[model samples]
Target: LNSPESIAVVVAKPIYWLSVALKPIVSFLGISTEFLLKLLGVTVKEEAPVTESEINKMLTEGVAMGAYEEEEPILVENIFHLADMNAGDIMTPRTQLKWIDLNGTEDEIMEVLKNANHYRIPVGTDSLDELKGLVTVS
Candidate 1:
């Protein structure tokens, strides 16, 4: 193992490994520095939108750094989850809904409002299936 070729191989192994480990970081710095230099003193540059995964990552880091409460990330993540869901996932089914009937008596509408416990009650012609509009009870 003392031969010239053997010594070269031994030294090359560590150098090769070091280059492989640093390649990504070096490439990223090279590209990012170039981009920053181009954007120096520039304003209103169009940027890529922050993605849901990126938001989650940021929230996790913020929580770890004590910048955000533990519950904040859960709330933000739930909002993202909601964006992935259909209306049916959160909507109350017709059978369980309390709606206002246009032809119903005023007292009946008031009764529905009192029992509904919701700010906006659906308005329908005869039943929940025929939704005409919404009655907002403030």
Candidate 2:
């Protein structure tokens, strides 16, 4: 109280006295420091950061505990694979692409549609390389 150096005394004295006063009760009840602080109306701020492994562990445990069905992992894997997939990866090769001649008659077009089993067909002039545009049959 006499100098700035008494700040520690100012702070520590109350804590020391409070601890001394609470020791008998805490020891009698065998309460933890955190629980004691909570019982004293003091909120303890804490953080538990979750990692990838922890999430995986929790998911695996959930699967084992029947919280999730067996197909749940498949969905997670498909989600992961989605990021790696590109447009070309899932498209059919050029060799297997179905096309329709621009000069084809209505019967020819219907035949192509019947054989190709597709609602839309790519229109071309003489070959697939001379691509004109898409033809959608509604």
Candidate 3:
């Protein structure tokens, strides 16, 4: 029990247990620092953050002035909206998927990759019903 591994575990034990113990209390609070300070009878003022439209307007001006060489302005806009999106919300239909078989040989895989445009391809064992997983080609 006095070994290096055991010593490391003992040192980390408090951190793990403390998180487990505090998780519930932390979840219950679910308040800002200002809220906690107010509970303790301290004065705190919180400011509202800048709106998304304001930031987008600034970026639009930057693009209009030719500050960015490429189409970074459009990219920033897409990223801003992408933050509020989920993969499932934008997933292609199963009928329109470009997939490959799991049991395909190297030659078959090479052929598929040669003609394919994407890096990640859905893999299936038998049919699309038995889809194993996705394969990412480097």
Candidate 4:
């Protein structure tokens, strides 16, 4: 009977060889598993498993460095799973967004700008659900 280490090596060798052989085919098909894994915060480096804090730090650093903008947006056809994203991920969420009311007077708009400390505010009728336009403080 083969030793456990010998059997494991035999099993791993074929998988490694298969991956190398399939690399070109995968590239041709635009299937970048490595890229996806990287996006999911997986490190190929020979280090211990990443902690939540480490992942958060990496994500913040990536965002600050504009790493995502550097890469081409992933196409739908090339994706295996539905991408996990939120409205806040792509744009400002309603809660964080500052806006002015359509019925608000110029004085009222000025008051909002003074209080809110924002450069731009959306003008809406009744509520933000009915966006009229944008007001810039300049």
- Lowest summed-lDDT stretch of 10 residues in model 4? 72-81
Residue 82 local lDDT, model 4: 39
Of models 3 and 4, which has the larger lDDT?
A: 3
Per-residue lDDT for 1-138 in model 1, tens only? 459998897799899999999999999998888788778954456899999889999999999999999999999988888989999988887788888999999999889988886789999998777899998887
* Runs off by more than 4 Å, candidate 4: 1-92
How accurate locally, in lDDT, is each candidate? Answer: 0.89, 0.80, 0.79, 0.72
**What TM-score would each prediction reach against the true structure?**
0.43, 0.36, 0.41, 0.32
Worst 10 residues of 2 by lDDT: 50-59
| Pairs of colliding residues, candidate 4 | none
Give the TM-score ranking, best first. 1, 3, 2, 4
Q: Model 3 Cα displacement at 89 (Å)?
A: 6.3
Off by over 4 Å in 1: 1-55, 60-75, 81-89
Decoy 1 TM-score against native: 0.43
List, residue by residue over 59-98, the lDDT tens digit for candidate 4: 5677678874423333321232234565555577778777
Better of 2 and 4 by lDDT: 2
Ranking of predictions according to lDDT:
1, 2, 3, 4
Report the C-alpha lDDT of model 3 over 46-95, residue by residue, as the tens digit: 88898889877887887788876457767877988899999877787788
Worst 10 residues of 3 by lDDT: 27-36
Query: Clashes in each model (backbone N, CA, C under 3 Å)?
Result: 0, 0, 0, 0
Which residue pairs in candidate 1 collide?
none
